[model samples]
Target: MAVKLNTPIKLVLFDVDGVMTDGTIYMAESGEFCKAFNVKDGLAIELLRAHEIKSGVISGKASPALTNRCQKLGFDIIETGCKHKLPKLEQICTNFNVTADAIAFCGDDVLDLPIMERCGLSVAPADAHQLVLEQADWVSAYKGGSGMVRDFVDTLLLSQSNIGLKEIYQPLLRKIALDDLTGVEQ
Candidate 1:
């Protein structure tokens, strides 16, 4: 079934690496791995939860950090270590008792194609790979691990109802200003 954009979406699915992070993996000599996540994205999830929309993470690689972050973010589901993400997504939809048309999927790489194709609404970050971008229903202006997820969430919220645009955009602008100042300071 095709997703109806104007309807209330029940769930949002995310890809961890490129969609959540900036598509970079940091490995230390101590065998520890890390990925940077945006504070704005976290806030977005919080706002979505407040509005009764559930979120989840689906990734091809399993990372302890990702697990910890998902827990912190209060995600409804976390499916990791799955090379084929579509089956995991299907299972998630089934478990949630929601049809595929009520779900949105965001991703940024070739591996994300299958799930993206299956989702009702598909999104890709501005810096997404060519194939991923081509398949997306929306391409965010912000890069992943920056503010892409937040951007998408805000768009969804606004589409669903009237969220004061200024109120929604102000914090993001403030954060960017702070980041710019911090960069100069460093």
Candidate 2:
């Protein structure tokens, strides 16, 4: 079944390292960095795109690996090297005209709290920092880089049940057309 959000969960932002990857920074002899991401998490993001909910990535660090992943996942917005995520997230909300309360952010560290507090739904992985887990509205059953994102997305999809009857599935192009009706310029 597909999940459709009228407004409550219009956008979902994710933290790259701890939330998507295992939070390991592998530095090779040539100063190359490598990060391993869960395939299930990638599929979850793509599923959201199919369901009319846009997804974004706001990470505190930058890496070619992260960029490649975002591109492959068809992320609606991607911002890296942002230690302070709230500010960048605010800009994204403004551009898309997404209300603060309609955004859901998933993170796994203390640095993610600022934005987490502002968003309507705050999600944390089971292995998230103590403070982060404390602040989250929902904590995943799975650990980061281990299908945790899939777990979060599943719960979000399930929550749409009480949101009223609507379409169960929306094709990508139709979803994009509906999104334009909102103040989401592009």
Candidate 3:
């Protein structure tokens, strides 16, 4: 599909399971569910904040790992255990004082169609469900749980300005380096 980012996207919302993780749930021996998040995606969230773009996540099922990731990333909105997301999207629009057209959404399953259809720009990872891929305005070259989020953010930033990808990743590289050198999470 042809790629076109919606301009002036004030809010960007993501679906958790398939869009963030690889739609896999690993249950530890303690019965706690674990999910692996990509560091590049974390950097993408930071980049969004740096650019003054609001970011959020909506998930049907809630997990402590997901909550920690969202909190650490400073997401503007985080809705979990939400079976129906359309109403949440409406509430988000009201809370942010922006219309649906100003929102960009990334989702990877059939359940996400309602919000996807309503959002200004709909995105999906390359490994997304067939139905989702068919409808998404932009499909990332990378799969979820890889670099899809970074790809989306890179495209969004590029569409909004002349900033190069290298420029966008420079700050993240410094942070990662500092964290590695100090043995402390950044």
Candidate 4:
């Protein structure tokens, strides 16, 4: 179901593990951690930025992979190693000068409940925990790490009478020739 926000969305927050990486953690023999990220999700963050809507992460766990990905995505706010999300969310609201009613938060587990309750919009992935799904104002058809973020962004923008992926991304193809295409360096 589509959720029309009472306030315009100024900021969008996401929980990292389940919401961003399908709740998977890969640990190397040397004790390093690796997490896979969807490029489409990165593009979704960019889409929010293009529309002057800030995006951020508030996650309990910390890892180098998550750090690098958030940087590459150019997130407006990044709060990792955060055990209690509600307080951090409050601080983020204060720091960003945005009220809770103007925020949209996507989460996938129980830890996300408090913040979800406070934000103007609460979104969850299709495969999210039942509790989270119940709390969500809107749910994506895609599961976490599988274009869930993209679906959320698409719906949010569309609800605002704003442009979607084709309008924002299709022009890039015209700007760069296929012959010049190369894999992303990062």
lDDT of 1 by residue, 107-175 (tens): 999999998898888899999999999999888998988898989998887777665766765655666
Off by over 4 Å in 2: 1-7, 162-186
Residue-level lDDT tens digits of model 2 in 1-186: 243344579899999888898899898898877899999888788668777789999999998888888888889999999999999988998999989789999999999999999988889889999999999888888888999898787678667654422343345446567778885543
lDDT of each: 0.84, 0.84, 0.87, 0.87
| TM-score head-to-head 2 vs 4, winner | 4
TM-score of 3: 0.88
lDDT of 4 by residue, 1-186 (tens): 676878899999999898888888999999999998888888788778767799999998998889989998889898999988999988998998999999999999998999999999999999999999999999999999998998898889878766665776544444334426664443
Q: What order do you get sorting by TM-score, best first?
A: 4, 3, 1, 2
Kindly report which residue pairs in candidate 2 clash with one another.
Answer: none
Error of 4 at 66 (Å): 0.7
Model 3, 1-186: lDDT tens per residue? 344665578889999887778888999899888888888888788888777789999988898888988998889999999989999999999989988988889999988999999999999999999999998989999898888998898898777776787787676677778879999866
The residue ranges of model 3 lying beyond 4 angstroms of the native Cα positions read 169-185
Error of 1 at 79 (Å): 0.7
lDDT score at residue 81, model 4, on the 0-100 scale: 97
Candidate 1 lDDT for residue 109: 91
Query: Which of candidates 1 and 4 reaches a greater lDDT?
Result: 4
